[model samples]
Target: MMRAFFNRIFGAKEPEPLPIAFGSIPGMLDEREAAARAMLKEQTRDPEQNIRNGIAQLQLIVNAIAGSEHDPEIHPKLKSIAKNTLPQYIRAMNTAMAKELPNDSEEFYPAAVECVKNCLNSIRGPGRYLQIVFPDEMKASRKGIDTIGREINAITVALGAYRKEMAALSDARSRYAAIISCSEDLAKAAEKNQRSRLRIDEMTGRLKEIGQEMAAMPSDPGMAQFTEMKSSLHQLTVQLEEKTRTYAALSMTASHVLRKAEKIATKQKHNDEIAFLKHAMALLSDHELPSCTELNTALAAACPVVERMIGADEIVLKNKEERAVFAETGRFCIDMVQICSDLHAQEDTCRIAHEALDAHPIHQKTGSLEREKVQLEAMLKKERQSQTELTEWQQKTQERIPVLRDELKNKMEGIIGRTVQYSDVFPESA
Candidate 1:
């Protein structure tokens, strides 16, 4: 009595919510579906048999219509019209009912509804004329239809709620599946983020070590020896350059005269000497250094052809540079051959010095460190960019998860008709 008095004064307390584990949502949906299906089976058990009996009643009505005799007082025109149309109506209704009914409720409901429609249509169609012919039989068929309709109405009402619950369960299951997939994706992203951070830290540490080593490298004793070797190589290179210019000036002057000789030789048909002059010019103009001994041999044979051509006055020297190099043929040949030998010797010396310096330990270590640092910096940048992208994706997915969770909660609540409180909380990280 005290409780009743208090209840009258205040609204009833809200019912306690059902507790659901987040991970068990799929299982819950399966259990709910099975329970709903069982409920449907219980409701429809008697209805199904009633529908079968109702179909049997319809079949008897059709057969009775086929054999029903017209009353003596009936109009001849009405009897004739019914006689013509009754067979078609009976055939159509039987065909509608004759179809094999599905065994499952989802399938059976529609089939039963269709059978009901066919039964009603048969009575409402041209079978209306049977009222006068077989009034008693027509009355019994309508009462049978009424029996089937009541059962159908009951099934319809149960199925409406059943279908709504199943639909909500289906929606909840789909939303839950999406949430699971997103969670897995988030876990994978977090794992990759962990690896990326480790790699970035590793690369940054290596870069720092390289910087420290490179900063202290200038004071190392081996650097002095490396510098000394570098200085020696530089001096050799400068001398080689100067010697190369001197050799080029001499070769150009000699080539200028040789060209004139070759043209004359072509006209004079001196094939042997033309070959010699062209081969010598090739040695001089070649981008790669020609063999110095081979060049000396070629020039030894080729310069005299230009000398004889000058002696015959068939070719004239064009400039003072050409005259100075080619006027005294014996002196010019001797000078050119000596300078070619000197150039070859200097090139060999410079090449050996360069190789020796490059092979030094300090030079190799410094170059290796520089290359590694560049590679590490590039890798670090790439990792950092991936970190940013992973963070952005995590943020968006974090926001989306809650929306999906709430939606799932609402859908599950609709399915069960009870507030659901999730037991398992989402993890902060993997």
Candidate 2:
């Protein structure tokens, strides 16, 4: 008695579940599903057939209710109510029975349940009113609905475990497929990471070699001349900068006075004077040094405008620099002309020196190696970035594989009714 009471309390102690492997899950799941389907068909066959026969009995009862005549002695009110409600109950029952139940277990289960519920509702809802008038028909209809309900209940009880097993089997299939796909992706990512590492090493080593070669490059025959030209270019650049600065200061001051002359000329409608003043100011304000001849010509025309403005008191020189520059406009023009000429000559010399240096093997080789070094550094950075992303993916994938394996193991244990030991090797975690 105690043993039976304990057994009733806990049901039966389940046996240990069977073991499976990560790789064999698909084939095993397929075999289990096929067996379950065959079992479902066998178990559901009699119940489904009974449900159909019960439905036929229910439909016949519904038709009998439709065609049966009411008693002439019955109360007028009850007869009128039955006349109205009888057709409604018949249509409801017929509509419920109209559904053609499918043969598949998955589809047949719900469809059978729906028919049972609908038939029961029709009997409970409208048949209650007609019970007195059509007593035999209503009683038969209720019995038919009960018969169908019982068969549907039997199907439900029989498939409860099958549904749970199918669900577990389906879950195992998904987990196993995901594990396989994850393994493939992890492998491809690892291969790409390896290639990236190799390429990065190659570029890194090449960069080192380039650095060594640049440092140990032998002296060339024209190196002496190249050094001399480089020094000459630097000196010319310095001299030209000084000359340009001096010329800018003087020209800006003179330009201020010239602008006043231009405004006055505009008011007086002296187009020629305005043009001369604007042309000279443009040359001084230009980013590049104007030709010496261009400066001489522009100043020759424009200086007279500033001098005339000073003579006519149309402009006032505020600063000492302005006064000095405008006070001796002829000397200023001469100095500007010499400065621009020297700048042009120096720039030409610098240009020729730059060309010679660029054409030399040492400079050309050095520039090429430096450019190559920069390119290799960029490629190495990109490779490192790719490697980092791949490493992160591999880590996440490696972590996920074990989790999926554990879940699949649990699901397989549930489905197969045993403690499932996965017999497959897994990739190591990062």
For candidate 2, the clash count comes to 5
Q: Give the whole-model CA lDDT for all candidates, comma-separated.
A: 0.85, 0.85
Residue by residue across 1-430, what tens digits does model 2's lDDT show? 9988998998977766465555677788889988988888888899999988988888887887788789899999999999889889989889999989998877999998888888888888987899999888888888877887788888897799688778888788888888878988877887788788889889989999998988776566666776777787788788878877887887788777888888999999999999999999999888888988899999999998889888888888898998888888899999999988887887787788778878978788889999999999988998898888889888888888878888878888777767868665765332
Tell me each candidate's TM-score.
Answer: 0.76, 0.85
- Cα lDDT over the full model 1: 0.85
Give the C-alpha miss distance for residue 50 in model 1, angstroms. 2.9
Native-to-model Cα distance after best TM-score fit, residue 263 in candidate 2, in Å: 6.5
Index of the highest-TM-score prediction: 2
lDDT by residue (tens digit), candidate 1, 307-361: 8988888988878998898878778767777887887899899999999888998
| Candidate 2 CA-lDDT value | 0.85
Q: Give the TM-score (vs. native) of candidate 2.
A: 0.85
What residue pairs clash in candidate 2, if any at all?
16-418, 17-417, 17-418, 17-419, 18-418
